[model samples]
Target: MSIPLLKYSLSTQNQRVDGYEVSPGEEQPRAYNTDNLPSSVEMDEVIWAAYRQIFSEHQILSSTSDSNLESQLRFNQIRIKDFIRGLVLSESFRKLNYDVNNNYRFVEICVQRILGRDVYNEREKLAWSVVIASKGLESFINMLLDSDEYEENFGDSIVPYQRRRIIAQRSKGEMPFNLKTPRYGADFKEKFGMPQFIWQGPVRQFRPQEQRPKAGDPALFLGMVNDLATV
Candidate 1:
């Protein structure tokens, strides 16, 4: 049997060393964050972009010059975005951000669905729900819009639907992981067969490489949505 050597800090530049090196350079280096954030906020953006694309595919965010679509995707988007921001700024993601294996896995399945690829398997469904548990309402919205498969299926017009679908999902019961042991980290392995690692302090004393956008900001958070509107 192949042993899944757990890679700590899989979301950051200075990922923990497993038996084998993960990938060359930062191209595929595992990401870890004291903040438990996924490496490359751009990946996170892809999640949101996929959500928007899927929502658009559903026509959940469509609007006429006169009236809005029957589905309320805008409200959903706002609530979900707020939820994601809150999760990122939470103690869990901040003090010792662990990898969101189940969350990421779930999003992958959802993205596939948006692309009209094979639907989510049973485990995949659980993974999708785990995303909601990790980041709450915001994840719901972002996952829908930021999926690459979604972009492949629904070209352009992803932004508006992203916002709308979020509202719809929320109404259907998607929120935070309310627990008495709030300090306990969410489980990634049991949920999605990913290796789990505790959030220790920063990886020794290694510093992260700095990256800057050339033209205009890459457009993060609400800015991304606004940029979408402009497009």
Candidate 2:
């Protein structure tokens, strides 16, 4: 069963939220699992798509007017960094529930970072546009690029623990078989085979242990996770 997860607590051995530990009262970053939870892979894909749209379409040096493209670019870079920092640096992502708040906050940042504000100083505005549009977004965009099995496990579900009853319950939505990324989900419902869920509408329909296909061909697995605009 999914934990109630009223709130989420982050704890890391280092002070850095990326993967660090610090002294007491500072902040502990709790590790998260991709399975049964929003994953780094998902977050990375969203960030990259947002970055590509903003950086390529908008650039600091592209303008040929009274506007200071350089300054705008810098400001934009800062905004992107600041927004990303909010999620990584905050003690709690949101006030109500950590999981819900964090998820919502993450998506919000990606959108704002991709789309800049009008009132921003000419330099600040342009900077953000350029970064999100180009390589400037690379660093932040790559934050959740890769993940190992440990990171994917989300601290739930045991292998040797052997909870047959629990497994049977969860199996209801499982793909009914093991599969790899990209094409793995394709053979899901081949008469006694598992059912595949592509990355199309309605992500809630996809259950745990489902593999996310490469961002390049998200449509290949749209049935599994919705929100095409996201990836």
Q: Quick one: best TM-score, which candidate?
A: 1
Off by over 4 Å in 2: 1-37, 57-115, 119-231
Candidate models: Cα lDDT each:
0.36, 0.30
RMSD of 2: 23.8
Residue-by-residue lDDT tens digits, candidate 1, 1-231:
422222222131111113243535422212211122234564345344433333223222223111121122232333333333333333433232223344454344333333333223445445556656755635564555555544453444322222122232344453211111212234554656556768988766654545533466554355778879998
Top lDDT model: 1
Q: What TM-score does candidate 2 get on C-alpha atoms? A: 0.15
Alpha-carbon error at 2 in model 1, in Å?
A: 27
lDDT of 2 by residue, 99-140 (tens): 322223332333332221111233433433444444333433
How close is every model to the real structure, measured as TM-score?
0.23, 0.15
- Model 2 scores worst on lDDT over the 10 consecutive residues at 175-184
